[model samples]
Target: MSIFISKEAKDKAQGYWFGLLIPLLAGWGVSTFSMAALMSRDGPVSEMTYVDYFFITGWISGGLVVHPLCAWWVLLRAKIVGNAPCIKGAYMSIKLYILWIFFLLSMTIISFIWGE
Candidate 1:
């Protein structure tokens, strides 16, 4: 019935969770919100399939958000290239995930409420 984890364990878990979840969600969320925006503004798109949306969002999210953070984490946190506090990096990633999720949910709600 123990539920508490050590600080380092929590950080590692957070880091792994960030690696597992955020990239996929960020890509999908960005794509979905962007598609919603495009449809709302342009009114019924004939071009662009789901695959296109996926690829574009994957590229944007991975390139902009995930990859850079991964690089930094691998390099600095894991000591692959630099020296830095590992837990801090993990905490930062968690914060980023929270902000991104909040923004994504907010945009999705707005789209649902106001989109046509």
Candidate 2:
């Protein structure tokens, strides 16, 4: 409502440990699974046994950081992905939702126009 990142998003960004715990755990789970699969594919690495997992953890953290930023971006662009301040919500909304569709559309258009 106000520029970008409403009170809700701010709440999420500044959310309690429990709020962040979900994102962190979501990050951990996705990272762990992806790491296992990728490491299995790449065979073994003497350099590091769980490097892929580290990568996943990095990615998950990135997602957590990006989620709130994306929320802010939505506000500036008026691209609403309803209740998509979290990973799970964004995943679900991306499949079937006007807010997400609009946001995706805006990004595509912007990419085509700005080459970003």
Top candidate (lDDT): 1
The CA lDDT of each predicted structure is 0.57, 0.48
Residues 2-116 of candidate 1 have per-residue lDDT tens digits of 3547777666665656554554455456656655655555324567678656656755565356644653444354455332344445455556667766898899999999974
Candidate 2, residues 66-91: lDDT per residue as tens digits? 44444334333332433333434333
Clashes of each: 0, 0
| C-alpha lDDT (0 to 100) for residue 57 of candidate 2 | 62
Estimate the lDDT of model 1.
0.57
Q: Model 2: number of clashes?
A: 0
- TM for candidate 2 is 0.26
Model 2, stretches more than 4 Å misplaced?
1-46, 49-54, 79-116
